[model samples]
Target: MNRETLVLPVLAGLLTSALAGCGGSDDSGPGGGTIVVGTTDRIEATADAPAPLDPAQAYDTASWAVMHNAFQTLMRLPRAGSQPVPDAAESCGFQDNHSEQYRCTLRRGLTFADGRELTSRDVKFSLDRVRRIAHRGGPATLLSSIDKVETPNEREVVIHLSAPDATFPSKLTTPAAAILDSHDYDPKALRKGFEVAGSGPYTVRTEVDGDRLTKAVFTRNDAYRGELEPRSDTVEMRFFDDSAALERALADGEVDVANREFSAEQIDKLEAGRVAGVRVTESPGQAIRYLAFNTKAPAVREKAVRQAIARLVDRQALVRDVYKRTGDPLYSLVPTGIAAHTNSFHNTYGEPSVAGARDVLRDAGVRTPVKLTLTYTTDHYGPATAKEFTALRDQLNASGLFTARTQGVRWTRFRQDAADGEYAVYGMGWFLDFPDPDNYIAPFIGKDNFLNSPYRNRAIEDDLLPRTRQKAQRALAAPEFRRIQDLVAEDVPVLPLWQQKQYVVAREDITGTEYALDSSAMLQLWELGRGAEG
Candidate 1:
């Protein structure tokens, strides 16, 4: 749901509690040695979050990467498709045509790592806990549609939604719906640090220095029983400051694999066989970066102002100069390689032209030199982010239709200020919550978006999104999504910027680097093993 997928960025706060009793590290487990994974994403534990590993608080990509192995959801996104298949539950589907009431039956004899029996009661408790402790940055918002959970028996769990949502199964695949042991986690608070108790394939322990989580070590969960047949018995995730540091670890044989936050220059070197033992694995990415407007801000209150900026800006030049041609200019809210993606923005704005932009402002009777401040975070999306905003400032200012200035803030303060509407235009990145197309559409267009922008369209919010959610067959909803993208392009609530390619760097001895990043953009560490080079 946030940038943590590829670059969820940094979150910080004082620790409210000192937690975690250390667990043993497994040197020799299933696929043999400890497979260390490195990344630039740091652990963002806060007052409400006692541990970076807790499903209730692990919303960022850093935590979510490891959480996939430590926790099990009732349903999970499959290896190749957007549809979710059963994991903890034996089977799950809608019980009614309206897509409001859903049911799941747990697999028989499922037990936590500590040997506690898992049941429908535990499932009910885990889900209800999310509602009770609604952390602002947590993934709990993914389950906001759920009205209630009922456990009629030890195996049967039923969920009633406040409205129709066929995409609910995909939401269950996220960390928000992770099924935790009823005894281990508090019903109304977060279970902090690295202590983990779940029926997934792995059990976790951690090494931390104050608020900084140095590393997390995971071992096979022997008491587990589920469908996911993990290939590795042991894995370790190392947190680094940036991709440069992570690449050094990969080059020095300190870490088995490197994920996310690679610079365009570094990626080019790897592509040209400049990096010795390590090879780069690139896939069409599901991540996107865009500009969101404060709809009520004085500078961009009118529709023409936002459209004019969109017309004058050239996505191609921005990608070539700022991203070093490592990115594809995105023309739609939904990214390329995803089903239902369309060139809605491209169709509306056409090519970059100063004359078209000037006419837009003149016809609207707007005053010349529309004043606006472009706000962004310098520390989050690599060093290129500031340059990206700087490029935007130059483009808008040069057009002479707007007076644009750029503001750079650190990640912590940037998110707060964006939420507070302190900036007229906000720059943010998105990683998919689920592999489905709705993940790209739903979060950005609603009344209460993650962007904190007030953008609710009567036709979209009331009719289109609901109809799209009602379709059990996700592919059948493409028409609705197309219309949604068209409306969003016309409205210009948020501007589509660029889409990036997913990259993974691994040593020649590593295997299964291709499978590390799953369909939903979450890491599957269990896929890593000692074998031939990827």
Candidate 2:
């Protein structure tokens, strides 16, 4: 996992438990024997169609989680608190002039479960396919930097980019960029859904259904070669149709782990040890939730109108009421804890004030009494999202800056509609596409921002983003991102609302399961064994 993908629990507790010598936990929470996990399935907020299991075609977050376990990247980020580290590659660095050519030397003898030797050819093919498929608007836009990929030898893969990019390796860390067996997948058949073939520790055998997706099991690959040391022989990933039902399962010992969907109140209950033997671990994640304004909408077109509306949002109140203080207030498109993140916008917005918003609108000669629609997803991001939107509407309307109308959609149709720019303003959340500022910038800026916001800030698109991506380190990347924040604050196409902190409840029996900020929330199934003495 990449650092951007890491969640709340910091690296403060790396204390070696030597507990491994004592043997793994036997208790899978309140239940006995079977180790079930919980996931939300009622809402298909992402991945509505039959998608190719190929990394190039994997666009939705759900697919990425599944892919992360089955495939290995050249390099992986540290668990929440550590730094960006190597995973599949023994070592990686810039190999040529101006840092235009990047190279990673593969680990010796790395082989897929199918027994095909993993080579630079697989890496080249993976990236080449991302540019080719570009399905459902995958993160291929980031690959616009790539000019070509060359493998002179079996072990060394060289990537030539159109421009100097510091974030290229981070891109490789994303599931959209996962490497796969060239022999197992056909690039042409990817759109139609090919068999799920990958190089991670576990392989997908089947998809079954019950309270959780009872039949989804990942079996250990004896031929697998990667940094992660998985413990379980077979991981049965059970998907809960609902969070409440999932919680009941956890309380009743039906599942070994659950996270992402729990509310702050629910977190408190779990943390209080309401369910015996279930341990709750809360960590700071790289997740950001924001309100996206469709620039095409007449009301939000003017900079002053956008800025005025941004000022009226009570981020703190939302954190308190909606997230139960589990989330931190975020002011930028990028959340805290990620490399190159800036608080410039939050600094500018300051505390919410009705008078302040009114003044901004007044100065722009914009009239009040404007009614706008706010859209939110019903099923994705948990149940509190709709209520959060309602609270925002109440707050905005109470301020008398504007009258608010709310629209809620199920995850599947909602994403399609939102992407079509159906709402005047919508609530959108982003987990990092990668840990870099490029992921944050490219997705929300320019005409191509995912929301179809059509926010064309030439300076940011032309200068800031390019310069930042070209920089080698996050320190050098900061100034450019800071400038991007200024543009976001000045333009307000989308307002940064809040940063989320994730709370996960796992049966103490499950070890090494964690949430990363990047939204992957990938758990190493092999590292997860039953309780000690199992």
Task: State the weakest 10-residue window (summed lDDT) of model 1.
Answer: 12-21
What is candidate 2's lDDT per residue for 253-313, written digit by digit as tens?
Answer: 6666665477667778877888887776666766677788878788687788788777888
Best by TM-score: 1
- In order of listing, the candidates' clash counts read 8, 31
Assess each prediction's global lDDT (C-alpha) against the native.
0.76, 0.66
lDDT of 1 by residue, 110-154 (tens): 998888899999999999998778765566668889999999999
- What is residue 146's positional error in candidate 2, in angstroms? 0.9
- Candidate 2 lDDT trough over 10 residues, lowest sum: 6-15
Off by over 4 Å in 1: 3-27, 47-52, 192-195, 532-534
Indicate the residue-level lDDT of 138 in model 1. 63
lDDT value for candidate 2? 0.66
